[model samples]
Target: MSGDDGESTIQRIQDIVAVFVLSITAVLTAWCGFEASKWGGEMSIAFSQASSARIQSTAAEGEAQSARQLDLSVYTLWIGAKADEDDRLADYVEARFTPWFTPAYEAWVADGMVENSPFAREEYVPPGTEEAVELSETADEKFAAALENNQRGDDYSLLTVMFALVLFLTAMSQRDVKTWVGRALLGMAVVLDIVGIAILLTFPIKI
Candidate 1:
């Protein structure tokens, strides 16, 4: 081929590659931005759930504490009545024991009373104790999910930046420059695009 024809062929090929890069990079950048926004919404929802669960946990814990105090007061009264050898008063106090405290008190008495108090017994699970524990665990899970969502959002944002750079490089490759400079920019853009896509493939996708 003649020199002019060879140059024309190279220019055509470069234009084709640049067009391809621009098209694909633009799409990828939009996709990354969309994913980042979705993940940010997920993070916000997880954080809200965590906060709600934490509030429920605190409320349950307060209820449990209140129940424990009530049991303690009744038991203390029973102890005083028994020490005074007032069987009638002791019996009345024993009858007044809340349902939750009854099983633990019975178990302690059966075990010959405790250096480990009735409250220490496994049977001593007060009202709301289980709820408090479960709610606290839920709060922790939601908090962890929120953090993971935030990280994923950040990852997508970084990918968006990378794609923006790819677009920049691809556009610059078409500028009036030396042949080697154009090829170098195009090659770098292509490499970065491939790398960004590979990384995106490894990430978990959200709608």
Candidate 2:
């Protein structure tokens, strides 16, 4: 072929390659976007369940604290030894608190908070085993806050990941695309992806 014809052929080939890349990117972007949408639905359900569990956990912990207080008061009244009333109160408190303790500890265990199954402290002893129960409201409050934060964080992390995936799909769609409107959209998509990446990197996972 002539020199000019060869150059024309090369230019045509380049244009074809650009169009192919754009088309492939558009298709991949659409696929990833669908996956992200599916993930978003699952994340929503998981969040709702975690929220319900949190509310229930709070209520149960409150009941356990109350039981512990009663056990303490009864122990003090008996003094230096076990009395029938003290034993009865202790048993009652144990009954009321066991369910709460078991579930709360189990949750911690499931989240890898505790190393031992059926975990308990070696020195752990409830009220009526010795003296009046010394209530540390701060400890319980901190624990509740931790649990809440952990759950909230997990939910948010999952959501943010899905969002990031969606943005990635958008970015793929925009890359190497052409058209005045397409260019504008591509710019917006790049900005969104950057913001999404920033969010994912800046925030710590709750757990």
RMSD of each: 0.9, 13.6
The whole-model C-alpha lDDT of candidate 2 against the native structure comes to: 0.49
Residue 75 miss distance in model 1 (angstroms): 0.6
Candidate 1, pairs of clashing residues: none
**Candidate 1 C-alpha RMSD relative to the actual structure:** 0.9
lDDT digits (tens) for residues 93-169 of candidate 2 = 44454443445444654668564422243333432232222223333454555555455445454545555454454
Residue pairs in collision within model 2: none
Q: Per-residue lDDT tens digits of candidate 1, residues 1-207?
A: 999999999989989999999999999999999999999999999999999999999999999999999999999999999899999999999999999999999999999995467998999998889999999999999999999999999999999999999999999999999988998999999999999999999988998
Against the reference, the lDDT scores of all candidates come to 0.94, 0.49
Query: Candidate 1: lDDT of 84?
Result: 100
Per-prediction TM-score: 0.98, 0.40
